[model samples]
Target: MSEKALVHIIEDDAFLSKALSRLLGAAGYRTLVYGTANDFLTQLATLESGCILLDMNLPGINGMELHAQLRMQANRMPLIYLTGEGSIALSVQAIKNGAEDFLTKPVQKDALLNAIAHAFDQFQIDDLQHHRQQELKRRLGSLTVREKEVFDLLILGLLNKQIAYQLGNAERTVKAHRHSVMEKMCANSLAELVLMATELGLLDKTS
Candidate 1:
């Protein structure tokens, strides 16, 4: 219902584009229509978080290719392929390439709406993940160099003495650094610290 959940319509056919916009608008969705893929790409950053209703056949970049490009660019916008009957194979490929959903040409209203609803649901999940990652990055950024070193070792299941030996520091100094790491990361215990490290990709980076 909010403008932030806009349905971006990229269809070549003027009539169908307008009709889709009207339909979505009547259902309490905001929409922005474009006649070509290029137009949509040009204004992509300005668009709010939402789903894309993309016709599989566009003038410049075809829907399949555009979908691939979007993925390559790390675009998280959920895509619903509005393809023709003959483009079933392409639609499958689109889904395989990370499209959220698809619909054949002459799409049923209920089916389209349902797909849009599902896409928005996915967007919510993705948005939450993105924000969580950002928060983790901020927390990581708050760590001092020594605290980060201590954190890396702590998550590696190291004892304070072992970490002190590895970092060429006293055990008491290592303990202080470890405490700082846990506090900055907002971790309550060693197990929670390890989980936070795992979630922040710190484990993978060290491994």
Candidate 2:
């Protein structure tokens, strides 16, 4: 979270772009301006990070068109759309097109900041979940075959003694395997272990 998240603005009007840059800058946000949707698209590959603030009406490619292209191409950044046409229909249409917020021209500083803060909160949430998923995969990788088998059974409400009987192993061996599973999965308790497995989509809900 540095000022590195460039809020790319796509507006043909140079004056509005300049005003928006100044406004966003005053609000402690890093800003960038694009004269057209094509310009933004061209620079997108060079941008490894940041969100987009798009103007609905543009010269070459429109904001809605750009939003559609980005969504189709699996662009991950949040998009906030701005427009002079403050019609309810257009606003609803913008939301349908995957715009995070629909704003009219002469943007209010508070409203703009609020929308951006919400978008960034979502961004942070997504970032955290992505990292957590990666960590889950890493932890799952750390589990041994035996431990994974024991984990599968343990989540099914099977106790150590039952698991031992099913696996044709000694009770102590089953306990050791279960303990190792818990440790490798970073689970503090059996219930927590089950929940972890459920979150990882390991649980068959139909069953």
Candidate 3:
């Protein structure tokens, strides 16, 4: 439903690309057309929020190879594969690699629009998670080194006395650090602190 959302079309066929662009534009969407996978790759980092409609048979890098590169680059945009001669194996691999959908050539208008809508909806959800992670990182940054140490131990189900023993600090000092950790992390309960730690991948780092 976002007017600013742009659909990226990476089809080598000039006529089909133009027609697809027109179709998306008319349906209240913006579009970027690339004649080659390399062209799209060049602008991948700067590409705005939206999904990708990639032709499976590009001239150089090809669609699946491009998808792999995007994965390596950590581009989480939704992708829909368009293939003129889609095989079961190819479609299966595409889906396994996290493609939103696979459509045969001469795609239906309604189908294409619906796929785009679904992909954009997913983009919104991903964007929200991304922002939440960023905020968590910011809050984590606000902690002092000692406070971070206290936070790490506290989330590990450690008592203040246990943490003080491990850190060679007095119990009262450990208690003060824990209080600062809770305030800076904006967590009211141990459960809330643990959830933030999980969201920020701090739990993974500790484990």
lDDT of 1 by residue, 1-207 (tens): 354478899999999999999999898898999999999888878777678899988988988878877888899988898977546666667778888887987889999999999988888888899988898899989999889888888889999999999999999999889888888888899999888888888899898
How accurate locally is residue 162 in candidate 2, as Cα lDDT from 0 to 100? 95
Candidate 1 global TM-score: 0.90
As a TM-score, model 3 comes out at: 0.89
The lDDT values for all models are: 0.87, 0.84, 0.91
Better of 1 and 3 by lDDT: 3
lDDT of model 1 at position 178: 83
Q: Itemize residue pairs with steric clashes in candidate 1.
A: none
All-Cα superposition RMSD per candidate:
2.0, 3.0, 2.0
Give the candidate number with the greatest TM-score: 1
Better of 1 and 3 by TM-score: 1
Flag the better candidate by lDDT, 2 or 3. Answer: 3
lDDT of 3 by residue, 1-207 (tens): 465678899999999999999998999889999999999988877878578999999999999999999999888889999999998999998999999999998789999999888988877888899999998899999999999999999989999999999999999999999999989988999999999999988899898
Error of 2 at 101 (Å): 1.9
Name the regions of candidate 2 deviating beyond 4 angstroms: 3-5, 59-61, 72-74, 86-98, 165-170, 204-206
Judged by lDDT against the true structure, how good is candidate 1? 0.87
Clashes of 1: 0
| Deviation in Å, model 3, residue 92 alpha carbon | 2.6
Location of the lowest summed lDDT over 10 successive residues in candidate 1: 84-93
* TM-scores of the models, in the order given: 0.90, 0.79, 0.89
